[model samples]
Target: MSEDIEIAGEPSPPPAVKAKSRARTPTEIRLLARGHTKAALKVLVGLMRNDEATPAVRLSAANAILDRGWGKSAQPIESGEEGLETVHRVERIIVRPEDAVEGDADPKA
Candidate 1:
């Protein structure tokens, strides 16, 4: 009887799978830099032409331009406490007024 029981099929899997899924590619990096320079130039021209536009609007437009030019990445959050606590920070650089226009001398000069 004991030998008969040992001849049974392999044991079944546990109720749950403990292993995590593999990470997949989020987004294509090649498309990010495409047309970026042209889009930035256009945004700059728009800002120069529309002095009445608010700074916030201009900045939003700039961001949009960059986002469109460079496709977004798919950043997936892992299933863990670290994922919940993760934070992303973005930094922006603004061209000073004196430095914006061509052939303009430094304000301090």
Candidate 2:
């Protein structure tokens, strides 16, 4: 139930078109930076090699280089809800020497 009409001897304008912006995926972003990989690594290495830099800064740069070279080490996650600590149950069983032969829990056996 829509109609286009001429007003004041002028035709109506067309609907507005919105510009679409798409985010680059991780792979795409990495590809974009691939060209700068060498320079970036060089900068990191320079930072790592600079004795003037603080020990922590140097270590950070070294870690970054190592991460890129050999991938990052696996990290373990300890998940627990806020205000609560995660706990696990452990079970222990004791068997006497005689129980080993008959597989009985009775001490007499």
Q: In angstroms, how far off is 36's CA in candidate 2?
A: 0.3
Clashing pairs in 2: none
Model 2, range 6-27, lDDT digits (tens) per residue? Answer: 5677766888989888999999
Q: Write the per-residue lDDT of candidate 1 for residues 10-103, one digit (tens) a residue.
A: 7755688688977645454445655486776787669745769988877777766666669765788776665367569999998887666877
TM-score of each candidate structure, all chains considered together: 0.27, 0.48
Best by TM-score: 2
TM-score of 1: 0.27
Q: lDDT of candidate 2?
A: 0.86
